[model samples]
Target: MSPKMVPLERATAPAWRRRPAALLAIALAWPLARLSPHRLRGALEFLSRGAQPVTAAEAEDARNAILGLSVRHGGPRCLERSIAIALICRLSGGWPDWCTGVSTHPFEAHAWVEADGRAIGENPDEITHFFITMKVSVSS
Candidate 1:
């Protein structure tokens, strides 16, 4: 029998202002996801630290794919995948991983990207723990 397929999260559409750009990006990552693991890793390496612009579509695509696949696979590791993908998206825009953390109770892992050590989010304080494994420097 074929292995059971895990489901992925549903992605919400980006704001109307960014729909076009985001859509284009989403389409791009879909194919990239199919690349060999080594190539994907290399591409992600460049993407994570590259100073390229991250369009809304790319973020939306990545967010959707990670959420959906993790939910389908039904494992805690999904969070890491989510964080990694998110980090890559942020990195492409010249952001860097400042910290990482996990939920005390459930052991959910999350990484934060910061510019100059300051966290960016609607509520930065919500992301605590502040532990980081490795950091990829982005050139100024």
Candidate 2:
């Protein structure tokens, strides 16, 4: 039998917008979410080319700005949200590492963006805990 899929829960509420670029990236990323993971990664990689790497603070600001638009954050870690964060950051002239990971114990999937070698809002200790299935880091 096929495993039943469960919808992810929202972790953030709509708050403080005014970021037009982030809103645009969120809209663009919404369609990209329909693509397969591998394809989505490629698309983001293509889009991020030529953008300089962002620092941890910069990435966190991008993340908060993306969240400001109030895209649904999944337990504060959603694939679509992370993709939007990367796109928004890139569109804003910075690039952060986008990551996809899985934990095998009970089978959990998560996605997040990182900069300066750590997931923007996650604990440093949890950084290496998951087995990263895919990642697209800056290339310039």
Candidate 3:
């Protein structure tokens, strides 16, 4: 079946989390995006190793922060966005499952972060059609 594109809602971080630190982390995503995929994944893996499990709420906060910063600074696309989210979580001493996947019918690729097996800021069904190409776990 062809994968359907779902319009995702933007998550908003709590006012308390709208600080310079979060924005700074989001800003760093730009340079990271310039790296090759392999290097990007390796960097994220290094940062995520031995990280604590990120709670749903924490994941939401990071997602929101990324989205917000992206709006203001033209946030990076899927891969960079996912990496940024994971890195933001790492800053708080936790990490989410970073993933990249592709769908065959129309040939699309996407990247996202997950906590407890749930994709953050994405429609659950949207990712079902994708075959995961790479997944980096913080605990691993």
Best by lDDT: 3
Model 1: per-residue Cα lDDT over 3-116, one tens digit each: 434344344544565454334444454565466645654555565654644444554444444444334312433334434455545534633433445565444455444444
- List candidate 2 stretches off by more than 4 Å: 1-18, 74-77
Clashes of 2: 0
Q: Rate the local accuracy (lDDT) of all candidates.
A: 0.45, 0.76, 0.76
For candidate 1, the per-residue lDDT at 98 reads 33
Model 2 Cα shift for residue 56 (angstroms)? 0.7
| Each candidate: RMSD | 8.1, 4.0, 3.5
Point out the higher-scoring one by TM-score: 1 or 3.
3
The numbered model that scores best in TM-score is: 3
Candidate 2 weakest lDDT stretch, 10 residues: 9-18
Residue pairs with backbone overlap in model 2: none
Model 1 error, position 3 (Å)? 26
What RMSD value applies to candidate 3?
A: 3.5
Query: Candidate 1 at 76: error in angstroms?
Result: 12
Per lDDT, what order, best first?
3, 2, 1
User: Would you list the rank order by TM-score, best first?
Assistant: 3, 2, 1
